[model samples]
Target chain A: MRTHRFAGYLFILPALLFFLAFLVYPLLHTVYLSLTEWAGFDLKKITFVGFDNFKLIPPDWIFWKAMRNTFYFVVGTTVFLNLFGLGLALFLNNSTRFTHVVRTLVFIPVLLSPVIVGVMWSRIFDPFGVLNQILEKLGLIQTPIFWLGAKNMALVSIIGATVWQWVGYDMVLYLTGLQQIPEELYEAAMIDGANRWQMFRRVTVPLLKGVATMVILLNFIGGVRIFDLVYVMTKGGPNHNTEVLATHLYEVAFWFNKMGYASVISVIILAISLVFAYLRSRLMSEEKA
Target chain B: MRKTWILLALLLLCATLMLPAAPKTTLRLWSWNNEGDYPAVFEQIIARFETANPNAEVEIQWVPYTEYNEKLKATIAAGDYPEIPEIHPIHPGSPMYSLYQAGELLSLNDALKTGFPKYFPSALADLTFEGNTYSIPLDVNNLTVFYNKNIFKKVGQKIPETVDDLISLGKALKAGGYMGIAHGAKDGWPAGDLYFQMLAYSDGSHTMLRKADFGKLTWNRPEFIEAALQILKMNANGVFPPGTAAVDYFTGAVQLFTQQKTAMFYPAGSWIVGGFDTGFPEGVEYGLFPFPRISKVQDSASTGGVATNWGVLKKAKNQDLVLAFYRIAADMKSAQILIDHSMIPPYAVNIQAKREILADMIKAQAIAQTRFVFTPELHSQVMSGVQGLFTGEVSAAQFVAALDRVEKTIKR
Candidate 1:
């Protein structure tokens, strides 16, 4: 028994070392960096400023704007992704030949890199692009709309692109969850004189609680750390209208060379993600109970 | 037999040890100038350098222009930068300035004192920071209106010489169902350059601009606000292509101009001459003209400076080899290579213009003014403000106010 336990420890030692080296060490270093004033060069030259970086965060309007934008993306993506994912899953539950083709077609966007998605969507939303031409043919408006250029529409456009790419992923996850729920549950509900809506509400919703929690949590976290699409499309531009926490952090660290302040922003993002994770775990536990 | 074999091995070892080993050194250079004729130009220069120093080799790393600055910064932060890094757009607020401030660049004052090619005074001034020259200016360029002669002829429009004339021409072009100017405001720098040109024309000299940059003057001054308003006015008049705010420089403006989707001209730098020569469609005859003066009373000022230059890292191992390469690069031979490729070498060599447009560009560069300096934070803010103006997100006063707010936050 002792030998077997030692072998198991030895088997996992490499992964443990990798986890410590890559994850734990960087997290700790980032925390240390948040307290210092460093230009991200010359590790020896990092000056300990002790909460000064964090203090600067409150008065910085751009940082607050980025936070607000991130919040909007997270909430917006979560709601839409869940709504669409569950709807598509329920619709495609029958698994016909046509439904299979539709599933594959919808999943195509999920397989594309975010950078490619951003570029493709940018063209589609271009003022003189196909969308505008179609609208013009319909005589919907006199002039072209600046989808990515307009301050109000830029973030919304980014959100739309992100949801398009990830909705298929959510649908697939929900389908797996939906398949596991036995038909007997629906039959039992129907035998009790429950209508179609009541059957769906009482049986489907109750059974898929675990998968819904996972899908929503995954989306919330993904939205919080969103960077590449916003970067490639508008670059958080048109006057920082689409600026999010990740892109702002990138600009601060790389462009402005304010590594320490960027680290602070990173810590804030981590904190938000942790709080969400904790809430998710609580929800899961409560559901289990 | 064993004794004979051992004696032969001993003799072979002795002969190998007696022969002197060849000395070799490798010089690494990083640059964002990887497009068009730049690679061939660099190759020719490196071949000359290698021929002159038989034992020395040059390795060039070409980074894409968009990601070059960020990559350079990150590599330097990681303490892994190349020995000779090219610092482009060598102005007061450029990456060269930041690198110099961090004491990462090698001061070339002593090296430049002797046996160096003579550069234009203005070009040298742009590369110098606080009485110390950090980089050798490779080339200088200025913004000019690149117009398709065919489109201008079709529209029966003459070149505009003043701001008002340009506005009227833009309106006329728009009325004819053509895009007046195909500006790519997405990259931010192009729009910023246009605004700076407006400022230069408004102020005549860069005095107020310099003062505002150094925090000695407020950015919300009438001249600055006027420049902002001018850009907004151009946008409002349909002077720019639709979706101009979202369009990027290369894929948007350059493509539109080359494809004849826009009429009249594009406000861009002279560096694009070489690219346009190759990229422009057949029968797309183009011409160069200076940026129109804001007022007839004011002299037309071209906004540009040294577009390409190189600096040595302080921690470079092969400083002697790097200096040797620089000496070769600064020679008239290298200048001829760049000139042949349509680049304006900083050297004062007599330019025998191969193309009529190149001659016009050289003339425009003669009266070129250096762009206004800004701190990195302030520069980013100004770029955002310019984009906002084009996108109708902010008005001229609002843009100026935003600049003032950012300027106030910078500590000296």
Candidate 2:
């Protein structure tokens, strides 16, 4: 038993070191930096302006706008991505050659670089873009609805793109979990005259609870942290409407030369991440129990 | 496990392959050129410089516009950098106030004492730290309001002579399909500069700046709050388009102007001249205006400083080459070509300073009598708070209070 524990520690050591160096170290340092006014680049001289940075938080509406956009994106994507993923997972869990090909194709978006996805989608949302051109030809409406033009609609477009990229990832995770379920149990249930919904609810869903918990948590984390696609596509613009935490943090630290304030926001984000992670793991435990 | 290790190794390989190894030859340039398409200009400039001087080559990179100071801080921490970046668009001036205290950038007073004064005295003088010029200007840009001549003609709104004329005339123009003026409130800088125009004309050039310089926190001064209120008043009058606050300078200007949605777009001359047709949209009948002075304002004759300038990075490998490049680029001949192409050329000795296309633009510059109106530093500081005020998220008093707070914080 001791030997097995030792082997486990050895196996985990590299990952633990990586997490400490990249994640933990940065988090701790950022928390420290949050209390000081360092012009982000110069480390030697950081004026300790404790609490002043935090006080500026209330007036910084752009910061709140970003956080709001992040939440909306997270919630919107989390719900839709799970649904689409589950639908895809169940459709392909008993895959034939055709379904396997379809699954692989659906996963192609995940394979594509996020920056490329953003750029391509931005082109699609252009006023005379392919999607609009096609929709117009189909007699969908008289005039094109500006996808990224209006402030509210811009957030919707980002949500759409994010869900599209992540649905496959969620689907693959659920599919893996689905593959582990015993076929005999489902067959037995059917033989006992359980209907499709009944088998799904009583057996499949209850069994997949652990996977569902993880997927939702992962989706939540991803939704909050999303930056690149939003940055590239909208840049939180048409009047700073779509701005989120990561992008705003980048602006504050780098653009505005307010490293202290940026660090405070970073620490807040870290706290949020940790809370979500804890809740996720707890939910996972409850589901398993 | 085998597949995962192989995949991890492959990923590492790809990451390593992506970062460019340090070059065999060394040249360092610090520029504000961030857009991918526009980096081509620097490439051309670098290629020309390299051809002229064969011993060294160049590497071009971008600094995030917002976190530029942070990147500069990191470079400072790194102990050695090739050269400092040039022409930081929004530098608050008082260079190295903190950095100088730490001994970062060099004082370039010697360069200023030379004939460099003759090239761009105003640009050189403004960036002077403690009565000495510390940076050489590569170029100068000024804010020029480009009205769609077609829109102006349709609206029959001749150039507004006073703020009230604008308010009244713009309303009548709003009855036409075109927006009276397209600049909006949500955008931080445009609306802020619009106030700068008002303040410059009203002898408020140093209203906020004095507060900032003296650390007095006087943003509640009647004129300062009233300046933003004037803009909001115009916005409320529907002088700008419906949903005006939502439009960015780029979208509100180019997007609307191209669609004939509005009558005027206020952007700097560098953007106004040829930039629109190539990148944004094709031609709309365009003409330039100096920032309009209100009818009875005391300093209506002064121009606001929206100058684009160049500076040398301390670690720049080809500092002499960059200096030489500026000398050539700022020459009268080059300035003429720019003016002939419809630019409001800022070089003092420029060849085409007398050109007809640039006549009104030049006249406006000549009329910018107070001259201090242009730096935009105070305007830059108070813009966001003002934008918040414009958006109704804060009251006018709250907006002034925000500026008052900034004045307390940043005033050296």
Candidate 3:
């Protein structure tokens, strides 16, 4: 018992150190920063104004608008990503040579960096860009409606770009789950006169619930933190219509140097992330049981 | 005999080692973007100084324009100040002014007396803070109107000379399915410039920027509300694209004009012919115009000076080389090179008409419009809030009110 305890401590020390340095310390420091104004620099002066920065955000309607945009992004990406990822996995799990190529192609978008994806797609979606040019040549619309310019569609446009870049990531997770599924179960279902749809609905889905649930939960936390894609595409613009919480925190901190106000935002974002993560993991576990 | 020979060999080796040490100490200099993104002419001058002072070796480090400010700030914060850098204060939200209040900016007034009297006077004004000269402005880039001749020709609207003509021209161009004025409001700076240009109309450039300061929440004031009204009218006139709130500057508005999708654009002098590819139709005649105010103001023609300025870090290691670089940068040879690269001269010049394609911009510049020096702090406030006003999302009242509320927060 003494040896086991000592070995456990030795095994965890490296991970604990990493967590302390990168995670716990930063989180606590940021919380402390929220109480005092420090623009990530300027050690000379720090003004303490507890909860005042939080109070200031509500009156600034743009903050609420940005929150709303983030909510839209989270819900939009999370729900669709799970469905599409699972669908692709189920279709490609047959393990034939042709299916290997299909699986490889399905997983390609996950490899691209979000910033590069944003820049490349901006050209594809521009007025005279390849997309509009192709569409015009095909005589689709009379004139080019700027993909990023239209206030009504800009958020959706960003979502489309983000989903294009991440659906592959979700699909790969589902593929791993599909592979773990036993061959005998499907064979048994076929013998019992279970059609492909019935097998998928009953055996395949129930067994893969663990993987699907994990993927969605992980994606939800990531979804809320989405910044680079939206920032590069729209910059929360057309009047904070596409602004998310992370970008808002950045503007308050870097642009305005309202370190205290920025910290309050950072704390709020962290809290939201924690709550979402906890709820997602709970729901996934309950479904499996 | 053996002892004498060893002594002679040692002395000869010592003499050879000291020969290469005759040159002056070497300094490393960095410049941001040959694309003329620099608000001052520092790099072009440094090259000339190296020619005159052969003993002093200066190495130039080329940094890309896009993230130059970010990278430069990181370098300075790490205490690695380059010998010759055109510094801008980061606190006013340009990322350069933040370093200024921290006392990282090196003062330069004592060095500029006889050596740089003909130095662009406004350049000195830009770098000045708390009655001390902190930077030297190589040139001042006042705002100008860039109009597309192709769109003007197609719409049959002759170029507008006066304020009313500009507005009416916008209305007619919209009817013709062409956007008349397309400066991006997606970013804060251009959006604030949009509103400031109106204030330039109401109170003139000098009073609007310098006197009626944005330090207070003058939201309830008539002037503040009227400033918003100008924005609403211009936006309502349908001169901007339908979804302008989403467009970022440079990548958005500049591209629209360059691509011939928009008829007119109002931007700082940094952009125009050289900002992008000038590959317009062979007959396309681009032109520049001064800011037109309400015909009734005391100074109806005054426009704001929206120039980028450079300064030296306070603890810079190589002051002599940097100052030497600044002096030779304003020489005529450097000035001619700047002109050839599609930039206007910061110093006084007799611009000959024969110098290629920039005659229109030069001609418009001669009208002698007064300039308002927009400090970085005020510029930051405008950049942070101006975009919201233009999208018709935040009313001018809300925009100014927000500015007033935050000004006290950041000013401290």
Q: Please report the candidate that would top TM-score against the real structure.
A: 1
Tell how far residue B244 is off in model 3, in angstroms.
3.4
Query: Model 2: per-residue lDDT, tens digit, A1-289?
Result: 9999999999999999999999889888898889988755456778888788888788676677788888888899999999999999998987599999989988989998889998788767755457777999999967665576565677898889988887889999999999989999999999999999999999999889889989999998887788899877766664466788888787666554667888988887877888899999889778768
lDDT of 3 by residue, B267-373 (tens): 64644565644545567667766665556334534343324345667788767767776777666776675666566665666655443345555444444333432
Give the whole-model CA lDDT for all candidates, comma-separated.
0.83, 0.65, 0.68
Give TM-scores for every candidate, taking all chains together and pairing residue i with residue i.
0.93, 0.77, 0.85
Per-residue accuracy of model 1 over B1-412 as CA lDDT, tens digit each:
9999999999999999998978678778898888667778889999999999999888999887667777876788787868778875333445445566677888789999877988889888877777788889877888878888888888889988887788888877776767777787887788788888889877755788777777778888889999998888877877788778787777767777787778644566656766677778788898878778777877777888887788888876888888888888888888888888787888678758688877777778888887746567777888889998987879999988988887766544
What is candidate 2's CA lDDT for residue B12? 99
Higher-ranked by DockQ: 1 or 2: 1
In terms of docking quality, model 1 is: medium
Ranking by lDDT: 1, 3, 2
Interface RMSD of 3: 3.9
* Per-model DockQ: 0.54, 0.12, 0.38
> What's model 2's lDDT at B196?
61
TM-score of chain A of each: 0.97, 0.93, 0.92
Q: What is residue B161's positional error in candidate 3, in angstroms?
A: 3.0
